[model samples]
Target: MGKLRWNILGIRGNPLATRPGMVKIQEKNVMLRKCWKTLLIGILFTLTLLIAGCWDRKEIENRGYVLGVGIDHVVSSGPKGLYDLDKTPQAAGQRKYKLTIEMPKFNKQEASKEVNKGQNHLIWSGEGESMFAITRMISTKTYFSPFFEDIQILVFSEAVAREGVGDILDFFLRDAEMRRLTRVFVTPGRAEDILKAKLQVEEVNSTFIGKLTANTDKAPYFAGKAELGQIAQALRSNHSFIVPIIVTEDKEVRLLKGAIFNKDHKMVGEMNELEILGGKILRQTLKQGIVVAPNPADPQHTVAFEIYEKKMNIDTSVQDDQILFTVKVILIGNLGENMVHEQDAVDPVFTKAVEKEIAAEVTRSIKAAFSKQQQLKADVTELGDLVHRQHPDYWKNVQDRWDEEVFPMAQLNVDVKIQIRRPVITH
Candidate 1:
């Protein structure tokens, strides 16, 4: 082929060129690039195997799920006893946190007669300057790791709540395992008492409280469900809110009127049962309640009205730089008990008089709630919320001082109307 062309420094034709079985310099470069890519991929795969996430993962069998938690302020140095739920250490002057974590024990399936029969749960507690520290210290005494995902309810003693719960809430809010739906409560006595109190119907104390709260229809007016989400939002926003109060009477837990929180995130005052009912009326959350009063036709006989529905209209205004609010409540109820059945339930005259008497009771409650609102200087009625939603510009100026300055001096007006839809007999 044209005498086989040969280049300089070559003994034969195409000395620098690639042969069928041999690699050229250009081929070596390509091979090196491919080898580098393969090496990088292998190294990445090896690293992925070494780096495992969630190092703290624990098996379900080894986990002790916390059902309910209670926090109380130590008043005095209680008896130093091991695994005592009610006892806690207290400082002389400074405040300390007493935390109780409740965990239900799993009954073992065994034929042995030595198995323990009573006390289905294990309660562990620790005292510390902060909840975060206390939680870590709890493991020092307990065998199992405390898991918080299953937590249902959180109870705070009045002393702890009065000192302010912002410090206590900080840890719970930051922890990803914390449940936002946990119902919150404030107790008059030690909060641990509510957690340790024996249950009559339900075996689990947490379940008992959860069911009791879920069925607020038992005492709807006085009992309010304040989830952790709402409480946290109120805390972050620096607004006034209310939490249901729990009382322990001889191992029995009973929910009572709401406890109010001011801008400082501390309990400034409390609402009585009547005022709590009235506050619910103002908020239009009164689902099922009984309004007892003297018979309108006969002053001696008694009458009871069961509320079925409520509608409230809150009219707010800023006149002369003074906050003015008018709450109009309309309740639709049924006449539950009538000592004087001689008066017809369908009679317009008799129903009108009954409506008047019911309206008077509602008015009295509204007045009573307003009196407490003035005394506390906090608007748990959500009056500020209305001003912010409808009147943004006005709220921007008064929001900071609404609880301390503006709300206490605001003018309030309450008007109530009741309509008895159908009368029922309870035998």
Candidate 2:
């Protein structure tokens, strides 16, 4: 006070000097600020941890992966009719569908290797009019959630197919969980029997059956795979389509026939092995198959020509409201096997003879398919679609009566040519 040196504040002595009490106060302020910053950072970290997780995440084991579904009609209300449904609130005549779902038996140890017989899958059955209710009913029977996202196939009995698949297919088409690529089939026997059948190839029957559709490239007898998505599209477009028929005998499952449907959305008829082969040829979907022909040298033995390449050309014309389809089939293949040991497949003359016979066989198959489809008045070969695509204006006129009236009377001319490229190394 005696010196009266002015500080920056103009209230104290030395401006450069700091007081001990003031130093303590500044240190306390710094420490308090650091504490506040640390507290704020800690709160932010805690909040991040609280919100950083999937609230509705479901583990794989908790999901019931429905691999296949079999739909059958309840023919009666007897013991075999659907199930003892006295417990559920099912309306009269509403219990129309028998829903069967197949799930893979998930055993981590056995999953790596193939399990013989039906040990690979589990089956559950329920009957109800509403597919939603039937599926919901399945939930009460299992601990895991029924997930249809992984479903591989849907099988309908022949009876159900005849009754009409539209009702059963409606749920699958509208469901968000169902995949479009799921294979569809019609079986003459019980649909449930197909799922229950024993297997030798893979762990799951549904997966194996789904894989079987891929064999269309190898087997011409197949009517090509009828996927659910394709069926849905056909239904919406009012287009007649084919559903491959699956048959089981002695626990052996086979896909050798195809069920044809008219524009009426019901099964009209079926195509046999030969007819299906021809249909594939007409559709230009014949990829690879063995076309066996009677050898000229030895009528008792047959010459097998393996089709590796094929091209089909169709010319459509409408005259006086009559549709005439002319199909030119060109087949390129190798001599797969020659049962006639005397005849050399390498000889040009022999090769030509074989080619001629193969062409005749192909012609016969095509004609058979065309005639059968015409007789049944079913346009399952997409002939109507062809008209719609090639001559839209003409199709608009005949679109309504195309399948029933026009297609049945339509004339088909088939021309087949075969070329044998090579022969198997063996005799």
Name model 1 segments beyond 4 Å from true.
Answer: 1-59, 78-95, 108-118, 297-301, 341-346, 424-427
Model 1: per-residue Cα lDDT over 1-427, one tens digit each: 4444443323245655445433455567679999999999999998887896657777665788898999987567667688767534544324467799888766534312222332667789987677877887788777787888988899999988999988788898888999999889998888888888765543567767866687675464575888889889888788788998988675667888788988788998899887877787666677787887789778899888888888888888889999788889888989988888787777788888898998998888888887788789878877788888988999899888888888888888888899998865545
TM-scores vs. true structure, each candidate: 0.78, 0.84
Which candidate tops lDDT?
Answer: 2
Give the CA lDDT, 0 to 100, for residue 162 in model 1. Answer: 94
Where does candidate 2 stray beyond 4 Å? Answer: 1-51, 75-87, 91-93, 109-114, 423-427
How well does candidate 2 match the true structure in TM-score terms?
Answer: 0.84
The TM-score of predicted model 1 comes to 0.78
Superposed by TM-score, candidate 1 places the C-alpha of residue 6 at a distance from the truth, in angstroms, of 43
lDDT by residue for model 2 (104-222), tens: 87775675454654566778988888887889889999998689999999999998899888877898999999999999999998898889898666657898889888877788877
Q: Model-by-model lDDT, in order? A: 0.80, 0.85
